[model samples]
Target: MSINGQPEKVENIYLTTLNEILDSIAPQNDLELSLNSILKILAKDLHFQRAFLAIMDPKSEKLKLSITHSPAKIDHVTYSPGKGVVGRVYETGQAVVIPRMSENTDFLNKAFGRSDEELKSLSFICVPIKKGNSKEDHNVLGTISVDSPILPMDNLLEHKQFLEVVAALISNQVSRLQEEMALQAQMLSQGPLLGGQEVPPPANFVATSKSIKQVLRQARQVGPSRATALLRGESGTGKELLAEAIHACSPRRDKPLVKLNCAALPAELVESELFGHQKGAFTGAYQNKRGLFEVANNGTLFLDEIGELSLDAQAKVLRAIQEKEIQRVGSEHPITVDVRLICATHQPLEKLLKEGRFREDLFYRVNVFPIFIPALRERREDILPLAEQFLEIFSKEYDKNIKRISSPAIDLFTQYHWPGNVRELKNCLERAVLICEEEVIRTYHLPPTLQTAESTATDTSLSFGEAVAKFEQELLVDSLKKARGNMLQAARDLRVSYRIVNYKVKKYNIDVKKYTGAKKNK
Candidate 1:
């Protein structure tokens, strides 16, 4: 094939490309999915002839082949210990590379039974994977082998080294997964908390979606520790609320949890806000004032929009975290503070780092543990429950008798894509509850955008209509509510005549006499 009219294929898989693929699969909670994605990328995207991993079955104690490339059909079930190249790599815990498959007697044509012509040009590479990271604890559990027939002869060594790096990554992931599964099993065996009641999720947060549940799991895991948590998501996705959950479940719950928005403060006042200034620090410094770092001593300090901090502010924050102390502005005295830091950002810190706007050192310091809040559009399962919760909250606050959302209103609630996430949903429910005169909130009582076709312009599928008559009916009802069901007064408030108001009220089947006896808002 190399001597034909076509040029030879080169092996040019870079480490960066491999890392990018692994990074994507890192978030996957399923072990089978992660392994399939790894092999799929190797065969399909990396242009390999065949790729597969042979993991040892725990009960059978034999190396069994996993899912392979779609083009190749291999019927071999399990390899005996120290038998073929695959078994030899697993038994001895060392990788093996065959420059020419047909030349080696251990090539084992019985495994795949390819033609001699194909075996003459094919190169085989197998790398053993260990169960743990330490070399002293070498428990060979599997082997990831690849058949790269199209590669040039000189690139075999580089490819072997690349496979070793991949095997190391596989080892790390397997070890972590095994430990996590063991811990979970042990916890479940301990049973529920006191009174047989299940441990409730974080307070004031609904986690119906799997994505948000995973975020909550990650947050609670790091709560008791002093590790800095980085909450990442788009604006209004409740990063601040998640910060509160982390602190509430943490050991610092007894201490005061200080909060600050890095973007809300002026650039000149950022340092003074983070680290206090002396009484005579600057022209405006009349009296000594402690900063957030000092105020949140022995507690959690949540810094929202940390990405908006200036480069100089980032440097000082990094120092405070590293040294466990901070120097106030225009003051040389350093005060020690024991604070648990939780940083949040809606902006991409990596993009800012590459653009020279953010310090790379500070970026690494705060990115220790990251929890991403799924956007409302991605977690639609939580919408109805959240809407109901907000409905109850606003009803009590506004002294309204609103009980539930109507079926049509619920349909519109789930159909519309919330761009502002939980914050927007809260506001939408609050508005709906306030305007709702009847026990239930109707579709017309919702925001105008939700009823229009604009809601469908985004990711949603509903291109619902907004009827002018429905809106006019709502206006008439509201005016009647304000006027205590009096026709002349309601018409004056609506800027229409009494005859037109009476016609609309009768046309919409409105019972004007009921509102007259009920207590109304001022």
Candidate 2:
């Protein structure tokens, strides 16, 4: 079969590939779906007379033939330890190449019940699958053996090597798949917090998609610079997290990090909060107060919601940043501050400047370096992992024994649009954990907004269930980030009872212990 002159059979199998199998496996979470799918595709694509995979049993010390592509009407055969080439190679954890069929006695001829004479024209190759670690324990997870009659010696060896490569690929893919799957299970079961995993960046930090890697690559560049940085994105896109990350990676990481939420503070307090005030400078000022600048002296100060600052406040900020000194509200002398400024805003500063809501000079001052964070919808690939992370966090916080987010719940999450970005997703999952009674967070427990958004988007062809699932997945992961895997604390932050939270812990089956905790101040 041919499609556009390419092998149609091969194309069909490759095109039929699904990521579900990959989603089912995790580090210790073993599932055979991914391995099976790869073998299926390989067998069909190469038109091999017989193809099958065998993974070594963890405790059995025996090679278990997990998948087979042999013709029906024949029972599948299992080789005893070191009985045949496949078993011997698996046992020794090395590659064994059979140059010719009749040369080796250890080469069993029991594949698909084929007689030795009939199988004589066929050559085989087997290689052991190994895991990465200092110890490098050799385990024969399985063998990918291909049989072909009337094949050339060179072609046979090449195909053998190719099959070995496929085996290695399967091993790696399985490892990732199992890890991801286990993470998902843990996220859902454990209420997004269990065993104390470090909370991840917000769901708005989505980067699982192919396109978002470039976005992250660009964002990473802004960290080392002394120039003022501007981060632009939709609200809930986790501008603050990115800003903090930048500060953490900067040269002044050892200094205090002062954050000013320009939008949250009143206009009267903005100037004083930023530049400091002398005693009796204002009606409530009985004593001198160090502003964010003084507090962050020689460190980095994050100015969030910069677009919300009034022109007057913006002017004061501009002066201190440009001159490296700030005069107190009622003081005669200017105090020097060696602080680095990193600003973030969801609003389009350029548009605001054009509309006269933001000052152009201030814009230019902070815009010396700009980092744009992509929205959750833009980087759907990161959704599920992030969600799993959140589930792990919340599970532990709520003190619930929940294990994971149900498959359907993940599917639902990936389908919705996160209008509020990571923040909104965090609220939604917290709510779900509060309401869910099962070990897993299911579709019924999802936020009403998510369901509504998914429905509306699907109706208009604007989004699909799969997309929402990805979004929710990211949000769930983001929520687990704050506590560094301390599920009980995560639950308190979410304001949910411990039991419900623990249910999610069990449902997602997350191991919070693996979450890397936040490093202490160096």
Candidate 3:
């Protein structure tokens, strides 16, 4: 029964252990218990010193240790993508086999306190839990790994294949558990509103800026009414967050608040997505489905990126708004819908109308109570508070004790223009939290772009007006240097009038003749 010099007894042990693991997992059984049981069996049968499972958090993009077989109690541990051998396996969607853990530089034993002498004799194997059959899909669900001192280098390939099989067997169960967790979270978010209680705005909606506060006030005022509102703002300015807040404050808070992104769907399916489709309405339509309008009856339907809708789709949307009814595709009867509409877009509807891309009639219907959300850069005062908020979230998420951002890091955050707005700031803070090992986040923890901007700026402590003036002066001097002290050329380079450039040169008190002589000699 033995293929190699290894005894057939060991091969039987592997098969028996795998079959037992498979039998232990049932649909009704607790997911964590089943996973822990499997890990325990692997540790015992394979003589592994340690076995563990780490699941990926889709929101924070961090791997959280879920189950471990070691006797020592290891509290919650998390790893960023590409941080260690386990992270590398998750990131690359490939199994890794390290015959000697000590020789591998990528092996980080920070979570488990294994001594250097112990690590030198240990071997490790990690495989990704993928959702799809094809390697091209590369949709990794999580990772499973085992380490032991008894694993022989010659049998490493066989162990790797065996672990990959185990990962494949458990992938579907892991995916189901993750989906259930997400659904539970969504239901909890809406639970208070459903219980006939007034739910306050989400705590994450941090707005100290006067402009954003005014926007929130306007949203609260318009929430009780049935009028369709338009949310106009730049991308990543938290328009969707405002929409959710409005829905929470509305009288129909108990009802469902369905959201759809117009840009995410195709033109052909837009109509069917907004308005329900009957069976046989199109190819692959095996069953009838309720559209967003029907699902959001007596509630709110927030359409994000509304400008991406086609003209035909726009007509159908306009009809739904004006008539308060939607006819299902391939059906004759028009179903009455009492859904409140809230549309958001980053594009200029006026320009779309002039270009004949958007219908003018539809514009007036949805623009009844227009609320404009200011970008993050427009409200620089709120940057630190938002950063601190994100830092707390990510710190807890990664199981790190990071307390605060350093003063230098805060200065850099304020000086940089957040092109992606609040979303960018949130991501930046998440990254800083991941990279920072200390209790405080420093400037080096931030992205290189923010660091470069901070290095180039002269003084971040200046008031907003003074900072703007300094920036203007620097721009004028740099332009003059490039134009060889010619004010007219500098004006053309800087895209300003010659008179204004001359005034800026005198205002900054620059020596233009030095540059002129250098250019003349060249």
Candidate 4:
């Protein structure tokens, strides 16, 4: 039977796979069972004698087998990107059809223990499983190989095409499963909170700022309660990250962390997308859809950019929050959703509330635990560390050898007003990495805005090193003042350690202790 010609069977399998994937998207799945079944189905339907899935090592560009089964071998086996026929196929992104293995010089006989005399009788088909660019980059995710006793290679093209299609399917499911499993594993590792309602914290969260520390403390304090949280910040100040941290520390972490960007979805579809719709609910509503609230039942619903929601959608969202129930567009039955709400927005909600734009009641409901993320300019101490983080991130991202920022470049970054905040800084570093030809990013690699400021400095001959020291002094003084002479608080505010802040205070010769008069209470 020709695998490609079985259109009805293939269609059924595809539909079944899609449904399974969609169901797996929800949090109520046993990931291991789902993955095991997915692999089994793919292997069976593809008629492969042996099938395996591997996850690509991001740094090494090598495939390490994650799951597999063979009649001869019990489980998956390890293979590098250039090892055997499987590796060669994955590395080259081309199908290898070896009718006679002994005749093929490219064939590596490590998979089969048979000698050249015994291998000459076998035929094999190896294909690479990859996404996005299936050609050229050979960003090989994994590979699938099928072998049989010496039989004439029949319809090699058709078999190769079928293998490629199956490879794409496997890639999609495997990537999704990996992400879900990783997230779930993290959630499970975090111990339960005091109350049954609080979620745990995400492991990747890093905080050096007192404001962030206090925010986390507050979140932990009230996370077990049913209070709504509002995260206020500039873009890239990690509002979403804070939200995730809150969710991880809450009781709802076991369920879904449903996210909705109010500004991203169209206004016309906002209501439907958030509240979902029943069949024939509107013009194109042919199927019943579950909204974010329902999807996030017994969990958290993170509404990002909440200030961007239209008035109508806002009213609907408010009702949903207040009543703990949502009415689908065409369905009268109100579905109860036990979800903790977390919202974030760059817009000033108080001003919007005063202007009658944001609903007062809704604002009150979500503002129970409001936390503000200080901009990069406000927290000057975080600049260097954040820059270092970005340098590491983008260096690995762009595969560049850049290790550090020069004194001049660091000065330019420190002096520039980061109006766009942390998000903009990351973008600048990413672009710099792409264009920088040297081992380090210099002032010239920075954006023109930053470069212009350094160029126009009054004391250019002071040396970039001296200029940087002066800037650091000014920044330290400003931060100390902002913290009202509380050195620990100031250091925390700057995302720097107490020692560093104290050292800077001594270096600048600022009598911070003297400034700690009556203003220390605030």
Best by lDDT: 3
Encode model 3's per-residue lDDT on 135-204: one tens digit a residue.
7425888899988774666677777888888888887667655654543444344443334423334658
Runs in model 2 deviating more than 4 A are 1-206, 454-522
Better of 1 and 4 by TM-score: 1
**Model 1, range 99-141, lDDT digits (tens) per residue?**
8888898866545667888798788998888864644324986
Please give the TM-score that candidate 2 achieves against the real structure.
Answer: 0.49
What's model 1's TM-score? 0.56
Give the Å shift of residue 218 in candidate 2.
Answer: 2.9
* Model 4, C-alpha of 73: deviation from truth (Å): 83
CA-lDDT, candidates in order? 0.77, 0.66, 0.81, 0.70
Query: Which regions of candidate 1 deviate over 4 angstroms?
Result: 1-199, 455-522
Candidate 1 residue-wise lDDT at 5: 50
Cα lDDT for residue 295, model 1? 95
When 2 and 4 are scored with lDDT, the better candidate is 4
Candidate 3 stretches with Cα past 4 Å from truth are: 1-202, 454-522
- In TM-score terms, candidate 3 sits at 0.50
